[model samples]
Structures are given as C-alpha cells and as structure tokens.
Target: MANMSMTKTPIAEQDPKVRARNFKEVTLGYTAEQAVEEAKRCLNCKHRPCMSGCPVSVRIPEFIAQVAEGNFEEAYKIIKDTNALPAVCGRVCPQENQCEGKCVRGIKGEPVGIGRLERFCADYMADKPMNIEKPEPNGHKVAVVGAGPSSLTAAGDLAKLGYDVTVYEAFHTAGGVLMYGIPEFRLPKSIVQHEIDNLTAMGVKIMTNMVIGKVLSIDELIEMGNEAIFIGSGAGLPRFMGIEGEGLVGVYSANEYLTRINLMKAYLEDYDTPIMKSENVAVVGGGNVAMDAARSAMRLGAKKVYVVYRRSMDELPARKEEVHHAQEEGIEFLVLNNPVRIIGDENGRVCAMECVKMELGEPDASGRRRPVEIKGSEFTLEIDTAIMSIGTSPNPLIRSTTPGLSANDHGCLIVDENESTTKEGVYAGGDAVTGAATVILAMGAGKRAAAAIDKYIKSK
Candidate 1:
C-alpha cells in the first residue's frame, strides 16, 4: 500500500556548529528505515511527471518502488541503468528543481525524498560487488576529451555498446570539475573515484594529463585511428568583474580558489600546497559557486565571510539548501549590494572593497528583475581577501586548435540538436556546448551524443 503521509521523512545531518569547522559531508544520508519510509511516499503516479524533469530520465517511480520494498540492490540497478553516477547525482543534483520539483505529493506537502532515497540505495550497495559483464569489442575506436560528467557518461554508454573507448583528460586527475570545482564537504572525492573505477572496469581506457588541443589535436586523434571524437572539456575559464584592484595579491577567482583547496589539497595540513589564510573574506555572486566559496572560507577559519550580490535572496540562483546551509554556518549575505572596486593596501594586497546599494527594477532578458544602482549609496567592506564567483566560459583552447569546429560568441561550442559539431566525426556536449551547467544536464548531453555517435559510426 502507498504511504499516505503528507510530509516526507527527514534525514539526519551534522550539526551546523560542528560541521562548519570540519570538512566532513553535511548530510548523513537516510538510514535504511528512513529510506523505505521516504520511498513509500511516492504515489507511483501513472503519469510519472517527476521523470520528465530528470535530465537522464532515470526510472523514478520504478526505483522508488524498489526502495519501498527494501529491495535496495534492485533499486540501485534501476538507477544505474540510466544514471552512471547515482551517488554523485544524489548528493549534488538540484532535485528541488528537477525530480522532486514535479512530484505529485509536493502539491499538498513535501515531495518524496527521492534524492535521499537514491543516496541511501547507493550507499547500501557500496561494498557489494557489481557483477557486470564487459561487452564484446565492436572494433570501433572512439576518443572522448575531458573526464568530466559528460565524457564519463558518454564513455560508459559507448562501452556498453561494445565500442572501444578512450577518454583523455587534461588534468592529472580524471573527474574534471567533480574533482577540482566542487569542495569535499558537498561531494566526496571517493564517490567520484568509485564511479570512474566502474567505467574502467567496463573496459573504458582513461588517459589523464592528456591535453586534447595541446598534447594532440582533434585531427591527430582521427589520424591515430579514432573513428569518432566527443568533446566535453567543460568551461574552466573563470569570469571576473574587471573591476579595479582585480590584480591585487589577495584577489582570486572562484575557480582558482576551489582548485587550490579541492584539487591541490591546500586544505589538508599534510599537503604542501599553499593557500591564503585570511580573517575576513568577500565572495561576489549569488550562485552555488558563491555559496561554496563563502562556506569554504568559513571552514578555512575566516572570522567573517560575506556573500555580496546585486540581487535579493529570491533572485539568488543558488539552490535553496545550499543558501540555507551557508546561513547556518554563519556566512553573511549582503544582498542588493554590488561591488564596484577592490581597495588594496600599500603592499599590493587586498584590504577592502567599494560597493553600491542596488534596487530591483524592471525584468531583464533573463526574466529576473534587473538591479538598478542606487545613487550616492556607496559603501565599503573591510575584507582581506576577495574571491570572484560571478561565472565562467568555455576555454578557447579546443576551438582555437580544431578546424571547422565553430563556437558561439559566448565561447560555447556550437552544436546541432543532436550534439553534432560542424566537424564530421566530432561532437561536443556538456559545458563545452552549453557553458556552465549542472552535472546531470551534462550527463544527459553526453548520453545523447553517445547515441548519435553510435549511429554515425554504424552508418559509416
């Protein structure tokens, strides 16, 4: 029988006070009983509206039904059939805006804890061996650029179709943004590595530190007998406000800051990487990256960390859960405030920032209310370090090196609806084609490109 509870089951989490000082994961995931109860909240709606919102189209109701029955391994299999990274998606994917957002139960009360249940099932089967049979090789060699969500997803799907797949990643590590962009507290590195291991076990070959454009061009991969190439290099180039004092010693881009703490292991005492130790820090933006930067500053022992945004809380683009967590950890939000310039000390280090108050005006092209600057409302924030978390664009290395592959004015690779680039036998997806986006969306693009690539190779 379906559980008729109006509200979803709540899961356990670390205390805000304690978790703020440590780098441990914040959510403790659902216990088995909790998972079952939460899963039961699923009405098993015949229409299955929740599945429509998911990028990779995981069998939402089917998996939840299995979880309700306590058949965890079965549930895991159902999720894994479509999503290659259930564990990573469960923790990081914005369920509130996706699966859980369209849930029927959410009409009157809280939606089913789909993400929580997914996480539970993944953790339940973590130690169990997956008896997967490697498909027979099809003799078609495919090369994927960048070992990010999209590339990994494409590689996994292609391998399942018996294609010989090779993934080349620029970084020494394989997980791309999953390893270097996100902090440990949100998504553990171990979960990412385990997923990568699964792909390798399926006969997917990964070559790290293999810069596609620098080490070898796309034409070279084709010359080396690769029948098809998929680019998922992602958008790593960070955007700045181009304000004064941006070149100051203490000014850092969110990408560089996160890379230092996450990939370079600067947060660990055992690691030799150097990082800035500051008492007061300012993060400029209102997206998830801004929240991450602010919360990370707090964990790094900053006495005060402020999130400066030109928009109000409602206009903030970050996930609500992340914003709430940041508040719980004592990160201050300076909404409706825009930074105009950074002030530097005589030693060329950041000492403060100049900002102006803003008010909401008419909606802009993005449909969000445009921020209008308030006249003579200038103010200053005393911050030793400033981290710019505005946004990012795709790096131009691949486009500049590869001929016949065109990119839009925004630096995103142009692709058709099928994710096929202008260059024959070459496709691009993820952030490379769409600019900065969610991991699940990137995975969806990769999955689609895999199908397209398969058709192209078989037709040839």
Candidate 2:
C-alpha cells in the first residue's frame, strides 16, 4: 500500500541554539529504515515529470525504486551515471525548485524526500569504497581550465572517453567554489575531496596554482599538444550597491567573507587568518548567498545577524529550505527594506546601516514585484559589520586576455547552445557563461561541452 502521508520523513538535525555556536554539520542523514520508508512515498509516476526538472536529468524513479528495495549500492550507481557530484548535489542542489518541485506526490502533500534519499545513497557508498579501472588513454590531450564543478565534470567525462585530460586550476587547491564559497556545515570539504579523488583515480591529471590567461595562454595550451580547451573559470567578481561607506574596514563582499571563513579556515582557532569579530552584523540581500552570509556570521560569534532585503518574504529568491534554516538559527529578517548607506565609526569600520522602507510595485524585468522606496521613511540600525551579497559576474581576466573570445554586455562568455565560444578550439560554460548559477546547471554545461568537444576531435 502507498504511504499517503502529507509530510515526508523528517531528517534529524542539530539543535539550532547549539549548531549556531559550532561549525559542525547540522543535518544527520537518514537511517536504512528511514530511507526505505521515504522511498516508498514515491508514487512512481509513469510520466516522470521529476526527471524533466533536473538539469542533468537524473533517473529519479529508477533510483528511488532501487532504494525502496534496499539496493542502496545500485541506487548510488544509478545516480552516478548522470551526476558526478551526487553527495554535493544531494545537499546543496535546490531540489525544491527542481526535481522535487515537479514530483507527483507534491501535488497534495510534501514531495518524497528525494534529496534526503539521494544523500543516503551517496553517504552509503562513501562508507564502503569502490574499485575503479583507469581508462586507456585516447592520445588526444584536452586542457580544462578551472578545477570547479563544470571543469571537473568535463574532465571526468573526457577522461572516460579515453582522452588525456589535464585540469589547470588557478587556486593552490582544486574544487573552486566548492572549496572556498560554501561552508563546511552545509557541504563538507571532505566530501568534495572525495569526489576529486575519484577523478584522480580515473587518471585525470590536475595542475593547481596555474592561472590560464597569465601563466599559460590559450595558444600555449594548444601548442603543448592540447587538441581542445574548456573554460569553467567561475564568476568571482562581486557586485556591491554604489552607496557611501562601502569601503569601511568592517565591510566585506560575501565572496571575501566566505573565502576567509571557509577557504582560509578563519573559523578554526588554529588558523591565524584575520577576520572582524563583530557583535552585530548586517547582510544586505535576499538570495541564498545572503542567507549563507547571515548564517555564517552567526556561527562566527555575532550576537545578532540581520538580513536586510528590499522585497517581502513572498518574493524572497532564496531556497525555502535555506530561509527556514536561517530563521531557525535566530537570524533577524528586515524585509521590505533596502540599505541606502553604511555608517562608519571613527576607525573607518562599519558602525550602523541607514536603510529606506520599500513597498512592492508592479512586476519588473525579472517578473517579480519591484521594490519602490518610500520617501521620508529612512531608518538606521546599529551594526558593527556589513556584508554585501547581491550577486557576481564572470571575472574579466580570461575575456580581456584572449584575443578572439566574445562575451556579452555583462562580461559573461558568449557561447552557442553547444557551449562553444567564438574562439576556435575553445569552449566555455558554467558561471563564466551564465554568471552565478547552481552547481547542477554548471555540471550539465560541462557534460554537454565534453560531448561537443569529443565530436569536434573525432571529425578532425
């Protein structure tokens, strides 16, 4: 009999009060029994609308059915066939808006715990190691710039096709944003390393601290016997509101803040990285990045963290799960307000934030209700630190350096439907082409580009 419960099985988590004070992972994954119970909730719709919503098109029903029968290992393999980073995606992917959003069971009740079940299978496989055979090299050298999700996916796929793949990363370590952008409490660094390790086991060569446009040019890579090159150098340029007091000492872009806390290990007592110890912090934005900044501030010992958003709760662009987690962690929401200026102290550090009240108006370009400032409704909140988490554009290093490369008005790389750039023998995708986007979307771009590169090489 089908379980008709309106609510899905609840995954255990750390107490909000306790977790807010520590950097440990919050959600404890489901047990074997719980995984089976949750898997049973899937009605196994014949149409499989859930698969359509996924960027990489994971086999949803097949994997869930395997889990329901307790074939955990088989489930992991099914997910792995399409997704390169199931563990990371299982945790960070916005399934509520993607796969689970189109679930048939979600029509009346909560959707089957798809993310949780996926997490279970991934975690299960990690606990028990698997042996992988190295693919015989195809003698064609492929150079992949940026050791991020997109490049990693491209490299993995190319390697599987027997191509001699070389991944060049600008940072000292690989994993790009996965290494520096996301916090460990959300997606652990260990999991990321494990995924990278798998690529190495498959004979993928990684070169770290190698900046492509500076240290090596597209011509240099091609001259070194590389038949093709893939660019996935993600968007690292941070955007800020052109307001006064933004250059204050305590003010930081969410990129820098997250990089320090997550990448530099400032959260660890042993690390001597300098970070502002603020009593109160204000994160200015409404997206998932803003929520991450606010929640990270709380974990870093800020007594109070406020999210200052221009739009109302209904229009919040962040994933609902993230918004809920932020609320549980005691983050104060200053909705329907936008920051006008940052008030700084004598030391040139942030002290307060001046904001104006906002009212929802007619739908704008993005289609959500636009926020209109109310005159004479300016207010001020006392804060010691400020973080701007608006958004980001692609870094201009590669575009400015490459002669024939083309980019749009936003500075993001201009690519065809097949992820090919204007430059011959060069392709680009992920944040370099789409600005900031989800991990799964980036992976899909990489996979598609790999196929196109393969076809191009074969024709030659």
Candidate 3:
C-alpha cells in the first residue's frame, strides 16, 4: 500500500542544545519500521526522476522497492552497483537539490526521506561483512591522486573491474576532505573509515602521505608501470579576500581551522593539536563550509559565533538544514554584510573586523542577486578570532609540474567529456576538474573516469 501521508516519516535527532555542545552525529538514522514507512512513501515512479538527479545514477526505485519489502541487503546491493560511497553520500550529499528535489512526493509534500533511507540501509549493513568476490587482476595499473570521494570512488570502481588500482594521498590520513574538512558532528569518521575499508576489501590499495606532484610525478608513475592515472587531488588551496589583517595572529582560513579541528582531532582532549580558543568568532561566508566552521567554533567553546555573509539569509549558499542547525545552536547570522578588512590589536592579533552593509542589485552570472555595497555604511564587529570561509581553488602544484595537463585560470584541471585530460592516458576529476563542488558530483566524475580509463587501458 502506498503511503499517501502528506509528511514523510520523521527521523529522530539529538536535541539542538545537546548536539550543539558535542561533536557527535546530529541526526540519528531511521529505525527499521521508520525506514519501511518512509520507503512506502516512494510511489516508485516509472520515470525514476530521482536517479536522473543523482550523479552516479544509483538504482533508486529498485532500492526503495527492496527497502519497502524489508530486503535491506538487496537494497544495499542495488545502490552499490553504481555508487561506491553510499554511507558518505547519504550523510553529506545535498539531496534537497538532487534526488529528493526530483521526487514525486515532493510535488505535494515532503520527499520520501531518500537520504535518510540511504543512511538507514548503510547503517543496517555496517556491521555485516559484504560478500564480494574480488575480480581477477587485469594486469593494468592505474594511479589515483588524493584519497578523497572522487579518488576513492575511482579506485573502488577500478578495483572492482580487476585493475591494479593504487590511490596516493598527500595527507597522512587516507580519507582526504572526509577526514579533514567535515566535522564529526555531521559525518562521522567511523562511517568514512568503514566505506574506505569496503574499498580496500575490493583490492584498492591506498598510500597516504604520497604527494603526487612532489613524491612522484605523473610521468614517473607512468614510467613505473602505471598504465593510466586519474587525478582527484581536490581543491585544498584556500582563497582569501586579499584584505588587511589576514596575516594577523588570530585569523585563519576555514580550511586550516576545520583541518586542525577535524583532521588533527583538536576537539578531543587526547589530541595534542593546538587550536585557538576564542570568546567571539566570525566565519566569513554563507556556504556550507562557513556553516561548518561557525558551528564548529561554537562546539569549541566560543562564547559567540557569527556567520557573516554578503547576501541575505534567503540567498545563503548553505543547506537549509545546516543553516537551521546553526541558528538552533545560537550562531548569529550577519547577513547582507561584507567584510572590508580585519582589525588587529597591538600584538597583531585579530580584535575586530570592518564590514560594509550590502543591498541586493540585479541578478549576477550565478543567477543570484548581486550585492552592491552601501557607501558610508561601514561597521565593525568585535571579535577575537576570524575564520575566512570564502572558497577554495585547486592547488597549482600538479598542473605546474605535469606538462600538457592543462588547467583553467582557476587552476581546475581541463578534462574532456570522458574526464580524459589533454595528456593522454592521464585523467582528472572531482574538485581538481570542477572547482569546489558537492561530494556526489566528484564521485560521479570518478566513476566516469574509471570507466574511461578501463576502456583506454583495455584498448591498448
């Protein structure tokens, strides 16, 4: 029987007050009964528009049908057929803009909790060992740069295809942004490790602390018997506003701040990583990264955290859930405000930030209203620390070192429709190809590159 309820089954979550203080997961996954009810809400549309919205094109309707029938294992298998990182994607992917957006139920009511159902299915099978038959080696070697969502997906796909796949990561840890950028309060490290373990189980070898452009070059990897290479290095280089006081003592980029707190485990008393303990913190940006930074600052004992954006609240680039969570945690939103410069104190530490009020103008290239600054509307925000979460670009190391690997002005690698780079037998994807983007999009690029690499290698 189709569930015609106007609202989908609600998943339980930690209280805002309680979750705001800890680094634990916010949303508790759906129970078996709840999963079934949610799955029942899926009309199982014949067109399967949800799959079209997905990057890797997971078999959505089939999985939902399996879930509805209480066949959790079968549902997992169906999703894993295309998606390599279901657990990660379920937690972090913006389903509202993708799968759930195209959901038929969303036309009249809330979408069938697709993300929540995916999370439920993943968590249900987390303890059970997957019964996977490792494919026979095809004798071709493929090197993947960066052990991020893209690289991991590419490696997993290639490994399953019987290619000798090895992923090289610059960080000491293997899970790239998953380990360093996202906070545990949203995406747990254990879940990420579990997914990586699944990939390794499929014969994907991961080498950490192996900086590709430095430790080994693309030419060197090719010479060392790597028949093909896929670069998913990701965009790690932080962008600044080129304003004053950026070099001050208490000012940090969102990348560095999140990296220290998440990757270095600074929040844990056991970890020796040093982080700034501030009374007032301002995160400059309105994107998801900005939300992560602001929320993280609150958990880190900041008395007050402000998300300072140049646009209105409606134009915030962050997920609505994230913004709501931040608000519930008492993080202030200083919308329609743009920072002009950071103010430093006598000792060269951030003490305040100078900002200008902004008003919306005509639509810009991004289709969002352009923020025009108001003259004589400059104001100052008193703060001890400032975290810039403006954006990030791909690092120039790989492009500078690897000849013929072309990149755009933003340092994003140029790739063809098939994800093949100008350098033959070499390919790039993920944030390395498209500037900073969603995890699912990066995974999609990896999946495509893996298929292309497989075809390229087999043709030789």
Instruction: After superposing candidate 1 on the true structure, give the runs of residues whose Cα lies further than 4 Å from its correct spot.
Output: none
Q: Candidate 2 — worst ten consecutive residues by lDDT sum?
A: 1-10
Give candidate 2's error at residue 157 in angstroms: 0.6
Model 3: per-residue Cα lDDT over 137-220, one tens digit each: 988899999999999989998998899999999999988889999999999999999988888887888899898889999999
lDDT of 1 by residue, 1-460 (tens): 7788898787788999999988899989998988988898888999999999899999999999999999999999999999999999998898999999999899999889888888888889888998878999999999999999999999999999999999999999999889998889999999999999999999999999999899999999999999999999999999999889999999999999999999998889999998899999999999888988898889999999999999999988898889999999999999999999999999999999999999999999999999999999999999999999999999999999999999999999999988999999999999999999899999999999999999999999
TM-score of 1: 0.99
Sliding window of 10 residues with minimal summed lDDT for model 3: 129-138
Against the true structure, candidate 2 reaches a TM-score of 0.99
Clashes of 1: 0
- Write out the backbone clash pairs for model 3: none
Error of 2 at 382 (Å): 0.5
Query: Candidate 3 versus the native: TM-score?
Result: 0.99
lDDT at residue 138 of model 1 (Cα atoms): 94
> lDDT for each of the candidates?
0.94, 0.93, 0.92
Q: How accurate is candidate 2 locally (lDDT)?
A: 0.93
What TM-score, over all chains together, does every model reach? Answer: 0.99, 0.99, 0.99
Please give the lDDT score for candidate 3. Answer: 0.92
